[model samples]
Target chain A: MQGLTAHFGGITWAFVLDLFTDYGLFLVSALGLYVLMSAGQVSLGHAGMVGIASYSAAVLAVKFHVPFWLSLPLTGCIGMVAGMVYCYLLGWRLSGFYLAIGTFAFGEMMINIWLTSDYLGGAIGFSGIPLLARWPVLLIVLPPIFYALWRIEHSRIGLAFRAIRDNETVAGSMGINVARTKLMAWMIGGFITGLGGCLHAHRVTVITPTEFGIYTSVTMLLAILMGGLRTFWGTVLGAAVIYFGPWLTTTSEPRDRLMFYAALIVILMILRPQGLLASRAAR
Target chain B: MAEYLFEQFLIGISTGAIYAIVAIGYNLVFGVMNVLNLSHGAVMMVGSFGVLLLFYLGIDNFWLAVAFGIALALVTGLLVERIAVRPLKGNWWNIKVATLGAAMFLENFVTRLTDGRPMPYPRPFKPVYYTIVGDFEVSNVQLFLIACSLGLMVAMMLFLRHTTPGKAIRVVAQNPDLAQCVGVNVQQTMVLGFALSAALAGCAGILNAVTFGSTYPFVGQFLGLKGLVILIVAGIGNVRGCLIVALVLGVLESFSVVAGGSQYRDLVAYSALVLTLLVRPHGLFGEEGRTGREI
Candidate 1:
């Protein structure tokens, strides 16, 4: 009995550590997507977050030899500023379908640039990135970030975000300053996502543009929406499922994994159209 | 030098027309439903693959294969509407993401079937380059692509203007409930709209395949993405704008390739989109007030 319990405990703890590193980074990135979606923007361009941050961090770490400690937070700041600029310059004027297309185009364009720019290693991807991030880095960074996102979700700005999401005309009439509120959401989301990107870059010794494409964006969105778009806890559940679900369901086939994910999304959307935990829109 | 430029322009316009047709497909669906069908791109690939399938089954006539291909695309588009879309009705965000899943499914399914390889597509015309002037050459295939796209656009416009079903589609676009009250059969109109849109995508796919002289499972990704870009840049529901913008983008891309190499051709289109978002938030030809901000 002792032997079985110890083995079980060992397996559980190991899985949890793996979860904190791999899934935790995804959660941080996903939280950025969550905030953006909360404002009803529905951007497909967000893969740029991972692309921009990971490459920047990788470049800074390898070329400039910036200490790992410095590069991580720097990437977040860069992402925040970049996000705000994109929102302010490009996003402020658009909404609905146009915004989706614009963002999608932007994301594709970045991928194109990544594929062509030989300076950034081109299609071969940037490799030999210092794998500085581990369990501790995520451990320290995650709790506070999770708390911050939760508070932001419930804050006055967060309330305005919900209002805008529920109905923009009403939210505007109620004086939500829809554009500025959206900007804030983008900035915060960008920052967190950038942090995730930096950690992710350091987690793997190589970085490829494929990691930051439409599928990644969709995958992040899936996690958030599936967990229930309204709460951080649901996001945690979503992160958990995405990490663990594949273990039970996925076969050795490579492309089949994407098919599995797409099928899962379709099935989930059909079963729980409002999301797993979504109930009445919070009053 | 001028001849070379002219040759490039001719090439650009033909490809642009192909894009215009694809955008028209998206415009039809978006106009009527206000939902962007993410699977539109995959369906374009479906059209090409559909024709390829017919060819495999011993269909020797190129035109006949095309007919079957368009039919296949129409079916797939309708299925997207029925399965990925309708069940998540009125939930705009859910519909968008679900359709995205549909796109992924189609792209990957084809990827698996073909092992992600580019397959050679059959062309209807023999290789024949026509010289309009000294060294200003145009291929018979280019002329056919240009003519068919223009012909299809004109036909679609006429259909929308003159036909009862097209009018019903217009009415639904204007207001589904009002159209339904007037006995327009809103659901049927929407299905028809999906069919027409998907058919157009089918046509565009074949045109693109013939342009490249081959097709691949992933070809739809770029083709479909370009369609959406042109759709917005041209302004929603503005058919004329779609033609003009798509042609201009195609021309610009052709020039950019000459100036900055083919690897950077996409920069032109995406930069244009970002610039449009910045300078003309309502799109180049879109109406001024509909920034989509309202609930």
Candidate 2:
């Protein structure tokens, strides 16, 4: 019994470590999307923001010889600015389905631009990115970020977000600054997504426009949807399922894996449309 | 240079006609159901594949193949409505996500079936070019496509105006509960609406397949998005408005290709959509306060 416990303990540590390194980016993205959805706006273009950051960081680090640490936060700032511009331009005018479509178009445009530009390494992809992120780095970064998000989820701002999400007009009647709250959600969400992108660029050591296409955005949305949009921990669980579930399964081929993933999503949606961990109040 | 631009403009018209057809179908579904069918493009692809399969099976007539393909698309549309749209009727966001899932499923399934290679469409008609005034030439194929698209648009307009089912559909679009109260079969009308929309999309898909001389599984993705853009630009539920906007989009797309390279085609198109959204959130013909919901 003692020998079995020791052997399992050694394997478990390695497995858990690998899981964190592999899924850290997805976890971060899920958190960003959770914030947006919590405010009752769905962004189909979160992956586009992530792509912008990844490319910016990779180019700055590799071409300009910027320090990795500086490049990371710089990418976050760029993401925040981009998000602010996007929200200011379209967030007020569009909501619900229209917003989804507009953001989707934005995502497609980003990928198309990346695909067409030669400086961004256009179809062949940009490679030789320095590996500056790992399990340890994620561990140090993620907990504090999670704590911050948790605090936001419980604060007055969080309460306002929930109110707006439930009904915008009512929230406005209740004296909440609906537009300002929505923009704030976008800003924070964009920064976190950008940070995730920088981590992904360093970890994967290569970046392609294809990696940040509508499919990536859809997958991220699916993760949040499956987990439950109302709670931060639910989003974390969803992100974990998305990143690690396929790895544990026996699906080896890429096509088969996608098929399985899509089928799983359909089944999950039918079985639990409100999500697996929907807050009781929301239900 | 003038002649080349004229030719490009004509080419844009043909392509735009296809976009108009797809957008009309999409607009119809959105009008009646108030839900965007993300799988509409996939349904179009299925139509293309159906026609291609019929041709491969020794159907020598192009129009016959088109008819069978449209029929197949109609059936698929009904299936999608039953499975994806109906189950999540009340929840708008869930319906969108489910339809997206359905889109992915159809696209990936077709991709796997085709082994990830594009299939060349066999041309049934011989290439015959007719020289027009000012030394311009138009092919019989292009003329056929343009004429057919216009004819179908007219037919659709007439159907909606004169037919009993068409009037029923419009009634439902205006108010489903009221339509039901007035003895209209809402379920059947919704199914009919899906069939008609899918039929239009299928026709557009076949026309596109013939125009390009090739078809693939994921071809619908871009066209589907473009159709949505056209629907938005023209104002949702406005058929005539969609036709005009689609043609303008196609012309703009061709001009962008001439100004920049072909790679910037999508960038130009999507940027136009974003700009339009910024300038006019309700679209050109859409009523105020009728941006997304049916009023």
**Number of the top DockQ candidate:** 1
Q: For residues B1-295, could you state the per-residue lDDT of candidate 1 as single tens digits? A: 7887887888899899999998999889887887878788899999999989989999888999999999999999989898998888757667777888898889988898888889999999697988876888888888888899889999999999899999999899989999989999988888899999999999999999998889998788788888888878877878889989999999999999888888778878898888887788777898887774421
Extract clashing residue pairs from model 1. Answer: none
Chain B fold agreement for model 2, TM-score: 0.95
Model 2 per-residue lDDT tens digits across residues B1-295: 7777877888889889899999999988877787788889989999999897788789788779888999988888788788888887556666777777777777888787778699999675998989897778888988988898888988998988899999998999889999999999998988888889989888888889988999999989878888988988777889999999999999888888888878888898888888888888887777777656321
**lDDT tens digits by residue: candidate 2, A1-283:** 8855553445567787877787886788768788888887778777888888899889988899899888878888887877787689777788766677688778878888999889989978898899989888888779977998999988999999889877889999999999999899888888888788888888888999988877788878888887886788888888887887665442435565666666666667777888888853573
Worst 10 residues of 2 chain B by lDDT: B286-295
Instruction: Compute the lDDT of residue A218 as modeled in candidate 2.
Output: 81
TM-score of chain B of each: 0.96, 0.95
Least well predicted 10-residue stretch by lDDT in candidate 1 chain B = B286-295
Which 10 consecutive positions of candidate 1 chain A have the poorest summed lDDT? Answer: A3-12
DockQ scores for all predicted structures: 0.54, 0.48
